[model samples]
Each structure stands twice: as C-alpha cells, then as structure tokens.
Target: MSGPWTEWDHLLKVDPDKTLVDGETFEDVCQTGTDAIAVGGTTGMTEEKMATVVEACGKYDVDLYIEPSHSNAVVHDDSLDGYLIPIVFNAGDISWVTGAHKEWARLDDDIDWARTFTEGYIVLNPDSSVAEYTQADCDLDAEEVAAYAEVAEQMFGQDIVYIEYSGMLGDPEKVAAAQNELDDATLFYGGGIHDYDSAHQMAQDADVVVVGDLVHDEGVDAVRRTVEGAKDA
Candidate 1:
C-alpha cells in the first residue's frame, strides 16, 4: 500500500502489437485518463517494439511502466517509470514462476529493485497467450485463489496480486476472495473489461482494475469511459 504502485487504482495496459494493428497511436491512448499505462504483451514481444511504445508514452506526464513477458522483450529506457514483472502463481511450468526471473537478473544489470514491482498473477484464461505460454492453472475455485493471494502477500512479499482472466471476463467473487485474503498488498484484476459496467464492477472487487484489448478494439473513447467507471467505483 506504500510504494511506486500505491497510487495506481486504475491502469490501462496497451499491447504494442494490438495498438499498431488497430491503427491508433500511443500518444492518443496515453491521454485516456488512466492512472497509469502498462506496456507489454504475451506474443510478438521485442525490445524494439516496446521501445517505440515507450517513446510515445514518454511524451505524456502519466506514469508509464513495462510489463515484460520474456527477458528478450525487456527494454532499457530512463523515461519509463519502472518495471512490473509477473510471477504466475498457478503456472503449470515452474519457469514462469522463477526461472525467467533468474535469467533476467543475470542478463540485465540495470534492474533497479527500488523501482521494480512484482505482480503475483493467477491467470484464468485457458486460451490466452499468457495462459498458453505459462501453462496456467485456471481451474481453481474462489477459496483456492484466495489461498494463493495470501501466499503471494505473506510468503513472497509480493507488491501486487493480480487476478488475470485475460480473454475472458473475470469472476467478481474470486476477485473479492483474493482482496479479502490480502492485507496490505495491492490487488489488481484484469480481463474482459471493455466497458464502464465491467470495469466498475471489477474496481469494486479489487484495489486496481486493469483494462487491455478494450482500447485496441474499441478505441480510446471506450477506454476513457472505463477509466471514469474505475475511478467512480
């Protein structure tokens, strides 16, 4: 509750691939009224592509962060606020939990721990790129998801606990269960949030609601509405 991410109650995650595909620029999306902007994606990720997006977002005064899916996709830029790396808690592959972390630390010497934040993710999309890459365990019940959240906060000392439903809409009861289990750690819920109502509902359940794909598919106007809903929630 007291760190670089403490103020981010509503975030808009923009995937560079999708943004460019939708024919919208990052400068326009950065002004969508979100508390922060997270740049990253599960597929087709590269340092060059990330740098392009970061450079555009740097023009804005908003907090800009990178959520790198792999070590190869990480970008080194002073303009970026920091990194938001994910540790998939229910990943079927152990590599997603810790193996990649060790590799990144070994490869990159510029990782400032003070500016870094780790998000413990319970990915719940069976068909998402993240789910496919991490081999996520998406069959857990609400109670079980809550247990993972507790472990992330107490054992791992995670700064953020993310319930990621990805391509599918999330279950509010599951989000609430994780929120109830966590004490000080920030809870972030992402997935299927394309409009005001869904974003508002998720905002009520978690400390932060992350909207992705919506901005690419529906444009910044739709993303702005979600930002309003999240803040007003």
Candidate 2:
C-alpha cells in the first residue's frame, strides 16, 4: 500500500494483441480518468506488439505500466512508470510462479528493481486464457481464497493481491473474503467489468478495479463510466 499504485482506484488494461474499438485512440482511452494504463495480454504477445501499444499510450499524461506475460514481450521505455510482474500462486506449473521470473532476472541486468513490483495472483476463472496458459487451479471456495490472500501478504510478502477472474465477473463474496484477509496488500479485481454496476460492485471490496475488454469491446466511453464507478465506490 505504499507506491505509485497505492492511490490507484482504477486501471485500464490494454491488450497488445487486440485493437481498440474503431475510431477510438490510445489518447481517448488514456484521457478517460483511469488512474493508470497497464499494457499486457495472455497470448500472442511479442516485443513489437508491446512497443506499439506502449508508444501510443506514452503520449498521454497518465501512469503507464507494462504487465509482461513473457520475457520476450517486455518493452522498456522511458515513459513507463513501472512493471507489474504477475506471480500466479495457483499455477499448476512452476514457470508461471517463479521459473520465468528467475530466468528473466538472470539474463536481464538492466532491470530497474525499484520500479518493479510483484503482483501475487489468484486466477479464479477456469475458462480464461490466463488460467489455461498457466494451468492455474481456479476451483477454490471463499475460504480458500482468503487463505491465498493471507499467504500472499504474510508468506510471500507481496504488496498486491490480485483476484483475476479474467473473462467473467467474479463473486463479490469471494472478493470480500480475500479483502478481509489483507491488512496492507492492495487488492486488485479484474474481470468482466463491462459497465458501472459491475465496476462498482468489485470496487467495493477491491483496492483497484481494472477494466480490460471493456475498452476494446465497448470503446472509451464505456471505460470512462467504469473509471467513475471505481473511483466513486
């Protein structure tokens, strides 16, 4: 709860592999009053694609972050405020938890440790691309979700605990269970936040409500409403 993201109540996640709604530009998305913009995707991510989105987003006066899915897709730019590295606590494979991170750290000496922070993730959607790619266990109940949150903050010492449902809206009870366990770690909720009510519901328990497909599917105006919903919560 003590960094640039501490005050962020809303974030717009742009997938490099996907295009924005027709006639909508990065400028439009960035000006929607979201606390920040996070660039990332689960699949088909490449350095070229990442750079394209980052360059476009860097033009606006907003906090810009790269949520790198793989080492090769990472884009280093002066405009970037930080890197939000995901460590999936429920991934069946070790690679998504720490293996890839170790490899990235070993090969890259230019890493800015100060600007990089780890997000302990609990992927809770069995149908999502991230769960499929990482082989994450997504069948946990509310109590189990709370245990993971406790482990993320007390055991792993992660500053952020993300409940990622990805393509669908998550259960608010489960999100609240996780929130109850966290004393300091920022709780981030991202999934099917397509409108104001969905965003506000999740924002009630989450420290930050992140909207992804909303911008690409519904455009900037939809994202603007979500920003208001999250902040207003």
- The best candidate in terms of TM-score: 2
Against the true structure, what is each candidate's TM-score?
0.96, 0.98
What RMSD, rounded to one decimal, does every model reach? 1.3, 0.9
Off by over 4 Å in 1: 20-23
User: Residues 11-33, candidate 2, lDDT per residue (tens digit)?
Assistant: 89999999988898889989999
- Residue lDDT tens for model 1, 1-233: 47666677789898877654366677778888898999999898988888888998988889999999889888878888889999999999999999999999999988888778889999987889899899988898999999999999999999799999998888999999999999899999999998889889999978888999888788988998999888889
On lDDT, the candidate that comes out on top is 2
